[model samples]
Target chain A: MSEWWSVVETARRIADGEVTAFRVVEDMLVRITRVDRDLGAYLEIDGDGARTAANEIDRKRKAGEKLGPLAGVPIALKDNLVTKGIVTTAGSKILAGWVPPYEGTAVEKLRAAGAVILGKTNLDEFGMGSSTERSAFKKTKNPWDSSRVPGGSSGGSAAAVAAGLCAASLGTDTGGSIRQPAAFSGVVGIKPTYGRVSRWGVVAFASSLDQVGPLARTVGDAALILQTICGHDPRDATSLDVPVPDFSAALAAGARGLRVGLPKEYFAGELEEHVRAALDRTIAALRDQGAEIVEVSLPHTHLALPAYYIVAPAEASSNLARYDGIRYGLRVEAPDLLTQYSKTRGAGFGPEVKRRIMLGTYALRSGYYDAYYKKAQQIRTLIKRDFDAAFESCDVLLTPTTPTTAFRFGAKATPLDMYLADVFTLSCNLAGLPGMSVPCGLTPEGLPVGAQLLGKPLDEVTLLRAGAAIEAAVGLGDRRPGGFA
Target chain B: MPTLTRKEVEEIALLARLHLESDELERMQSELGVILDHFGTIAAIDATGIPAMTHAVAMDHAGPFVSLGVLRPDEPQPSLPVDEALRGTPKRDGDLIVVPAIIPGAKE
Candidate 1:
């Protein structure tokens, strides 16, 4: 099997009888078993489930039945996205071994599309922090350098794709959870416009900002997954009523004649020299390909991180109030009911989760709500307006996905330090626009850095076309990190 | 401004229902101070007259993409068995799933 065959390519080959779904599943299992020991990307592997699904797809193909578009392709899901039978921990001991009775909308979509369910990848506890180090279970190591981190809260999914544990994975981005990790792991990750994908089955970190998206080896694969999973669902009140575009078709059209905007504020900070150089090179390549590059300013960019911390945590504090050791997760034994409640919660949640919850509670409190949470919401509007104004000038905006490559484990020890790690990508979630990260070039240390492209609302097609052009120019398709067993 | 005194930090921890190590509480007090310092800047932005933009721009209507439906379904569906529903509970002793007391002001 060729490593470069995306899920779409593999499915085509399988449908034509050139390859069997079982063959692909077996190869993935071998790769996961061989490499996942060190990476710790997966919390649990559903070998039997994957194999059974592949076999069923293979049978249908042989019988001349029209299979789904992603038939027989293996995909990993972030632990936050619920599956009926598989454990959904959201990378926290508080919900350890907790399996939801209903499948999430995205999971149901994948199943309907006939994709094989490989396993659940790890993530930050309740998707709270920027680094997966906030995960209560285990830290998902960077495949590029085992000692460094794979950026998070979707770090595990990004690491899994980079390590070849799975062809692609689903991750939720609420303030750069998906794209930051994608940048650090050198993979393609897309955050659909907020509410584009239903959030019914996924565990909520911040209801307003959370979005389920795909991380893959190629932009087209991510697009294919997005097309299948996105749509309005009655269950999610915020879900958008919109048409799902044919992203693969858009990819075929390429990025010629597209006007790309470079946000000046994104490049002026302590951004690593390597990342700046890589984006400059990518911009030159896009210009050479008949695309126009223009300078755009997002004046409210500096307030994004501050606004995100307040608004997200406030919503998170409200959403996570359900986990009070009452329904699921860990419970501690104590003398009386009050002691039980206090002790159970005190013992269960990790440090970062506790920190976020407290901050959120304070922000949402009676007197402070208007000052903190409400004020942040006003700024969030300004951030969105900045994007809208930039889009008026250019069809899309470009920025470095992250400020730097993956940092060594324990690099950002303080919680506030970790929150700053998502400086570049968080604004997209706050503004509710589709954004993506594509590999541009490697750093002096040979670590990969990614350039992000932001498209108009519900304009994932434009984002994918831009990404495909960059991926094609870089020619860095399907290069797994070194030392994979 | 949120000062986040040690006493307030402890109170917030109790309210959040998460146990914090002593060192963590001390550290959080200082870190929160730094964060609140930054948040102070955002609080200063005057948005008195601007209307709130909660959701992004709505998607363009190409056709009848949204299907209107009634709220209630007359048909009933099979539900999980009581025994099976409580299978993974941490502290279920009988038909009822046991849990920590949820009464507000019951604990310190």
Candidate 2:
């Protein structure tokens, strides 16, 4: 068996009797053991649980029963997604030892699809930071460059897939969590339309903005995983009650005759030279393939980051108010309930979490509500309108996923500097559009650069079609990080 | 950009129910001030005619399948088992999670 097997190949091989599910899972376990020590991609490696599930898949196959689409595929979940009977922590000391009694809807869907639960991957504490550096546990290193951070709050999921620790992993995106990390790690990550996936048991982080998606080696793998997880769920009121489209069928449509819009505001900023080159390469590839590339404008792009900061943190502050230490997490004893709440939270949350909570609380304060929170919401409307207008002229919009390649640890000295890392990816979340990052090419320094595709609401099909085209044109196939490979 | 005072940071922390050390409070004051300053750009935007988009489904482009509001029939459903509900509580007395006294000067 090859070490770097794509999710599609893994499932097909296992289904065709070319490989046993047990053997596939065992190989993944061995690879994770060998590779994950330096990467810190997984918070927990559920070897026993994964093997048990693999054995079940093999049994079902031997019994001549039809298997699910992801049968025998080993996948990891971002720790923020709860798994019943597994110790699930949102990379915060607050949830350090909490074992969820219920599983997230996505995890349940993955299990039903016969995907092996490899374990939960690390994330920014409560999905708060752009880089996994803010995780309360071990920081996930970029598989491409150990010295640099794996972009986060989905950093662990992206790194794991890049390192071949798992076939693919589920990552939650609020602002740019999943896509940014996938870009930095050189993998395919998609943030489905906000209401497309149910968020039932996932840890709440800026509830309105959060959406769970897959990070994988190829766009098809992501589509398969997304197919299994997305649908209307009564448990998640915000879930869209739309029929799931056949994404795999859509991939073959390619970029021909597609109207790809290049958002002018996205290109107006100071992008790193390598990133700019990669974007140009992607645009050229699409145009060469008969995709009509037109320049479009999203006038309110500059205000996206500012509005996101206010909106995400404001919602986070309210959603996180449930962790009062009296419930299902770490508790600090104090003479009074209020003091205990304060002490527990102070001790549990990391610096970034505290900072966001403070900022959010202040924004939602009585006198400042209209100025900060309300104003940000209004700006959100303008951002959404900008996308709506842009989409009218084009089938999809393309841009660089990040302003630069992955940076060295501690390169972003200030919180604001770190926040800027997600500037290019934030507007999509605010507008609730489906966004994907596909690797375009490697920089001169050997770091991978990604090109982002933004689609209209619930239009992941167009993004996938364009992404697969980019994937083929770039032709960076089966590339693995040096040491890991 | 509005700079937060030390007192303001402390007040906000209290409101957020986070106990901060003196050093952390100082750090937060400076950091929050910088972020708020950046947020001034959003404040400067003229959005007089725009309505606040509290949810993504509120957008006109959300498509036919998505409803602005989803209402499930209100019916009795099986809740989490008592043991499961209390499974992760830090301090539990039987099935009930234990908490500090809500009233001041109350005995434990």
Candidate 3:
């Protein structure tokens, strides 16, 4: 069996009895042991649990029972997605050994679809930072370049998929967590429309902006995973009851007769040369396939970063208030309850998490609410309006995912410099639109460049169609990191 | 650019229920000031008559992605067992989570 089998093929072969699920799981476990030591992509590896689950799949197949769509597929979840019995840290010291009593809605869906849970992948503490360097345990390095960071806070999931650690992994996006990391790691990542997937039991970051999605080596694999996880759940109030169209079916629809818009504001900024070239290549590819490329304007793009900083942190501050050490996770004792709350939180959270909590608290404070929080919300309205207007003329907007490819560790010195890394990708989250990043090409240095596709709300089908086209055109076939391969 | 004072940083930290060390507080004052300064640009935009967007979904009653505020029917569903829920707590006394006294000068 090839080490780099796509999720779709892996499932098909296992279901058809061409390969035993036990053998597939064992191969992935061995590969992870060999590769993940240097990459640090996983926080936990459930070898025993995975083997037990795989054996069940094989048993069911032998019993002549119909298998689920994702039968025998090994998948990883970002640590923030709580698993019933596994330790889920969210890469924070506070929840270091905390085991959730119940699994999240998405995890439940994946298990029901017969995907074996590989284990939890590392992420920035509470999904706060753009790079996984903020993870309290260990920094996850980019698979492409050991010196560089896997774009985070979904860095582990992206890197794992890129290095073939697991077939596909789930990642959460607040601002650009999923897509940015996927871009840096040269994998396909999609942040489905905000309400597309239920967030029940997933650790909350920024309540309004957070959405769970998939990262995979191929767009079809991503679509398949997405198809399994998405649907309305009564447990999460924000989940949309809208019908989920067949995403995999839409991929074959192609880019023909589609109006692919180039948002002028996205191109107006100083993008690295390689990123610009990738964008140009994608535009040309889609045009060749009869997609009408048009220049569109999302005028409020410049304000997106600033607004996102305010809105996301503010929501994070509130959502993260549950971790006070009294109920679960790490507890730093004090003489009084109030002091205990302070001490426990301060000790449990890392620097970046503290910085965001402080910023968020200050923004929501009495006199400053109208100035910082409310004003940012108004700007968010404008940002959403920008997309609303642009979508009127286009099927999807195409742009560079990040300003540059993966950067070396410690490259972004200050907090604000690190925040700027997400400038190009923040608007999608603010507007609650579905956005995807597909590896477009490699730079002169062989670093991967990602082209982002932003679609209308609940329009992931269009994004998938366009992404599959880009992946086909830029045939960086079965690309793997040299040393790992 | 609004520079945050040391006292303001302390106050915010206290409000956030995060006990920062003296050195951490000093660092936060400088770093958060720079971020707040960057955020100052958003204040200059003319947002008169604009409604604050607390959520991303539009309030339209009719559309493909319409807002349905309907909640699930209230019913008794199976919840985690008592021991299961309390298992992860750092300090627990039987079925209850143990914590410092809420009232000042109270005995442990």
Candidate 4:
């Protein structure tokens, strides 16, 4: 059996001095060495760094220092987060072996709170794909079924948490990268509102859409991870200046009297039979907890995917332009400058990354800008307006995190088909709303089903409150992936 | 139903600084064409006078582009050490990063 504890439980045991921090890190490292080859969730393990951090935590405890909230909790970081001296590849060959000189604000905050980072997890190259197959390094397998892919670009982070590789993990979500994988791996993933978590030191995909959040075994663990890393950072101009509410406190408040809207647009079509059945059960359970299920309509829902494909790539092209190989990362040389740029980029980026860059470049070209880029931005406004109107009737909107569950590897061969996998979760990113995925049920075949909760912009407290209630009622925590355990 | 032509795909590859093999180029011709066709719905929408959304979250009204909330203040502060900043550079010569000549010996 595994000695892996949830985030909160691990912290409590460490804070109480019942378990040494080094011991905890060593145990997790042991488990990782044994199982990570099968799961492929981690790209690299920082065993020495983690041991040193854990030893410091233990020393602090021995010195009678007050323990921080996440004292001794083992955490995994998505490879995109800059950790000084740790390679931050963002799952792209272009950045292979590039170690960041600075730390991202989120990683910095986690260390301050006494979290020991065990390793960097794999991701879709630059977080560009809905599935982890886009990762150039390693494809992360869904913990529930090795034959199936872990939904990604945050796939490895989600898989690591679900497989008990770490107490918690942080993953950045641009369009459902965090939540979709969390859903696929049967864990809880939260993508805070666009500005809630600072993006400084995190490699950018689409600057406006990317936000770092947590994946964990439970809603409470997600809350604990969020609490440690949230708050304004001067470095990130877009970071919210607003104070973070006690997310853990929100977990205590049950779903009583909360208005949970079931958006008709989300449930109307394309849902698999098993997933719909699970979502229906989740809705009934929420209703039993006194959450009033209001049926709301987000009329412009279907337009979101197309708009996101435009907006995200357009931004990605600009954000990814920094990889000229003159400054950081892998560089390819040629006789001339332009040739060098082409050669390095051609060799560095994967097909998915290249596809986005090309599409984005095409969309933003002068003549087509008004038709493709501007028009997409306008649709973005409409999508946000749809959410604005829905929030007037309900406190939080509920939907299936994905249309189906964990899909087999190579299932979505075409780019468009893969993009459609994020259909339900994309709108929340476009609207800049706080959204989370919590495991609710499983299909008859044993694949995990994720029920998503989306709240108004900056209204995560409401979303988490409902999600916690759903989590409590379902007792989804006990439903572990069999193979890893 | 806008579709990208082969020439257009090649042109876009040049602009993106990507050198696509013939196979990849042919694939993109069909893939990008379909992607653009899907996005045609955006163009189909009536968005006259509908303001484009530039930011997902409203700005602090004091960052950049003060008209619509830009970025953090322009104030200067301490930053990374010079060595740390240069550490990731693939080709650095004692604090100076070396790059291929762009302007063709205008100021080597």
Candidate 5:
């Protein structure tokens, strides 16, 4: 019943009959009752749904039937993921009353593996903004300091995991959504290589950049969740046919004989002093563990934010066009079809979503396509080329996850300023590389700092290996976000 | 930097089918201009000979990740049932999803 138990640890106890699935589910509900009111991590609490699932798992265990890998583990899901009979809001009021017809591929896999669905967590509306403030619903607070923001659009998932509200959670990283929040909240989160996991039933943000991954208190738990979700799905056209590796095996590999690269450009820029110090310490720890630390430069890193804004919005503009009043979700009553479309969208979407839609419309306008959208795609190629070249010199690359630790809720006044918070993590999505954020150390202010690891395509194993080594060296166990310790 | 004027912003909003309030219109103009100006950095990059990459990772049949050739036979597949599809519709009648009528002579 301890929140400190990693997903693997919880699963083992369940397998050995040390804890019944029902009891674990009950304990998780009790914890949520006591803690989640202050955090606002979960937008909806599905105690009944989770309990029913848990009871079924317990019944199977009692009947001498084998359980799945994640037996009885309660996991939080980002609101964007479609869950059968559960409200999937995507943190927007537009879809306030909509319950998806079915579940997402990742959610289905988790259910099959015996993970209980606790509830849907909050996010920036349609995953547009870095801070969860852009959510049409309530903003999720950082567990470390409620005044500070949990880096987001996956803010709720990160906060939930950080607060020990769930054993682990699933978050979709479209533009550093998962990693930056995980960094701020002091959890391990990964955005697997593009197409490593299916994007079948998840609400599309930026189809090309969106990736569903896990947020966990420990590296092993992150790997466990990632393992369960990775593989091919015909439903997603871009899903890879690659084999899902046994990620747990990589944890035992450690960091020895691995060459970890430090991208020079990542160190440069307006990175906060505490973040840099933490990065330096993380590098030293990895070097001490016999991993060769090399200096590499991704020269095109500076262009990531610009290219990403253009590319993601363009995709979002198209993907979100489906919300015309005729189908599911909120609709405004208007005399004409056009007016209904306008009113519904304008009233439903938040300011950030509107801004992006306008920007994307401009970018893809009749005459402006070549100047913006096409150019951004070309820039994406250059960004990928930079990562491709850097990987040749090192097995993995490391950098600070965010330029600064979590700031106050209203710290970023302008939309452009908020966009800058994602500068460090955006390049990975642009390049379609697998990357992760593992807590390397804490800032002097007691806020957590995450050091990111970037790996070659389909090479998450090396990143996890390095992450486990660094997690052990830094000992993420000491600092408690809200109440776990 | 290619800045947007109010007229241009209105036109863009029209294209996006979002009816911004008057104040929201003004705010959108300023905010979008700033974002587009910021995005000028990408266009400045000399991408003369580089082909545009629509997907950051190649999903082509020859690509390492999708090397197995992901072309599934295009046979009919089971999809969401009609009742399930219509379940969340805001307005519906007899399984036909409802919407505001097309304005007469209001050609899009």
Candidate 6:
């Protein structure tokens, strides 16, 4: 099997009897065993379980039964997404031993589509930080450069797909968790418009902004997983009731005559020379393919990061209040009742979680509520307005997914420095807009760089179309990271 | 600037039911102070009369639609037993649940 055969392609091969699902699963396990030790992409690997499921899929295929798009494919789930009978810790010690009785909505969808759950990948404790360093268990290293970060809180999922450990993985994007990591890791990721994918089973970061997305080696693979997962779920009240389009079909439409708006502000300030050059090359490639590139301005782009910090943490502070060591998590021994609450939480939660809780608690506090959290929401409207106006002039927007390529581990020590990494990707989440990150090029150091495509709400087809055009133009998906097999 | 002292940090920690070590507390205090100071960037921006939007869709949940069974209609549902509910509880006095002695007036 070729290393670059996406999950969709592998499924077709299995269906055609050219290769069995067992062979694909075994091959993936062998690769993971060979590569994941150095990558730190997976927190837990379900080798035996995956093999069992794959064997079943192969049996069904031999029986001449129809299969799902992801049938017999091995896919990783972000640790935050609860999996039945698996240790679903959101990369935090707090939920270290918590095995959920029920699986998450998206995981259920994947199971319905016959996807073998490969394992759970590491993430920020409750999806907090941009760097996977915030994970209490382990830091996921970048596939391109081992010393650099793979981006987070879905860093593990991105790294797994990038390093070829898994065919594809699910990552929750709450303010760039999915897209930024995809950018840094040199893979494709899509955070569907808010509510397009159900959030019922995923651990909440910020309820309003979070969405489960796919991280894959290619945009088409990402879209295949997305089409399977994007639909209304009675379990999630906020889940969108939009029709799920055949994203893989849309990807072949190409980028001809598409009005791609390049937000001017995203190109300036903190954009590395390499990133700017790569973005320019990507835009030029699209232009050559008959795409109409226009310089459009999202005037309120600068306020996105600040507004995100306020609103996300405030919502996080509320959503995370569920984990009091009283529901499903680690429990520290203490003498008194009160002491138990204090000790369990203090010992279990990582520093980043505590920081966010504190920030959120303060933001939602009564005396200052209107001044901070409330005002941030108002600005969120203005930010959405900026995108709404820009979309009127163009079908979609284009920008660098991240300002720079992957940075070395511990490179961004301060909080704000790491927060700045999401400057480009956060607004999409804030506006409930669909967005994608596709590999554009590599830095001079050989680290990967990615360009982002933003589309109108519930218009993932446009996002996928532009992504496919760029993916074909660059042909970066077939290229593995340096020194890989 | 939002001046967060060691006392305020201690208070917030207590409210959140977190017991921090002395060094951890001090470190958090300093970090929180720096972050709170940065909030001035947002505070400096003029948002004079804009209405705050709690939800992106801005649906009124407290209205008559709630009574029409749209907003979290109450329905009796099967759940785990008392033993199962207490299974994850860190502090359980036999069948009775226990919590911290939160001083009501102290928080205010």
Error of 5 at A351 (Å): 0.6
lDDT of 2: 0.91
After TM-score superposition, the amount by which residue A385's alpha carbon in candidate 6 deviates from its true location, in angstroms, is: 0.8
lDDT of 5 by residue, A182-202 (tens): 999999999999988999889
In candidate 5, position A305 carries an lDDT of 89
The candidate 1 chain A region of ten consecutive residues with least summed lDDT is A476-485
Go through the candidates in order and give each one's DockQ: 0.41, 0.76, 0.79, 0.64, 0.76, 0.36
lDDT of 1 at A72: 86
Q: Write out fnat for all predictions, comma-separated.
A: 0.46, 0.86, 0.81, 0.79, 0.88, 0.39
Worst 10 residues of 3 chain A by lDDT: A475-484
CA error at residue A123 for candidate 5, angstroms: 0.5
Mark the 10 consecutive residues where model 6 chain A has the least summed lDDT.
Answer: A327-336
Better of 3 and 5 by lDDT: 3
Q: What is the lDDT of residue A4 in candidate 4?
A: 60
Best by DockQ: 3
**Local accuracy of candidate 2 as per-residue lDDT tens digits, A362-387:** 98999989888999999988999999
Candidate by candidate, in order, the iRMS in Å equals: 3.3, 1.4, 1.2, 2.1, 1.4, 3.6
Please provide, for model 3 over A51-160, each residue's C-alpha lDDT reduced to its tens digit, 9 standing for 90 to 100.
99999999999999989999999999999999989999999999998888999999999999999999999999999988899999999999889999999999999999
Q: Is candidate 3 or candidate 4 better by TM-score?
A: 3
Q: What tens-digit string does per-residue lDDT give for candidate 4 at A1-485? A: 22468888988988888889999999999999999998999998999999999999999999999888998899999999989889889999999998888889999999999999899999999999877899999889999999999899999999999889999999999999999999898999999998889999899999989999999998999999999899988778787778789999999899889999989999988899999998999999989988899999999998999899999999999999899878888889876788888888988998999999998998899898998899988888888989889989999999999999999999998898999999999999988889999998788888899999999877889988998988887646577889988
How high is the CA lDDT of each candidate model?
A: 0.84, 0.91, 0.92, 0.89, 0.89, 0.84
lDDT tens digits, residue span A1-485, model 6 = 53458887887887788888888888888888888888889998888889999998988887888888789888999999988777789999988877776778899999889898989998988999887899999978988888889999999999998888888999999999999999999999999987788888899889988999999998889988998888877677777555788788898898899999999999868888999999989999999999999999999888888888889988988887777766567777654657777888889889988888888887887787877898898888788888989998899999999888888888887887887778899999888889999999787788888999999877899999999999888747567887554
The DockQ of predicted model 4 stands at: 0.64
**What pairs collide in candidate 4?**
B64-B70, B64-B71
Instruction: Give the CAPRI rating of model 6.
Output: acceptable
Worst 10 residues of 1 chain B by lDDT: B61-70
> What would the per-residue lDDT of candidate 3 be over residues B10-62, giving only the tens digit for each residue?
99998999999999999999999999899778878889999788777654555
Better of 4 and 5 by DockQ: 5
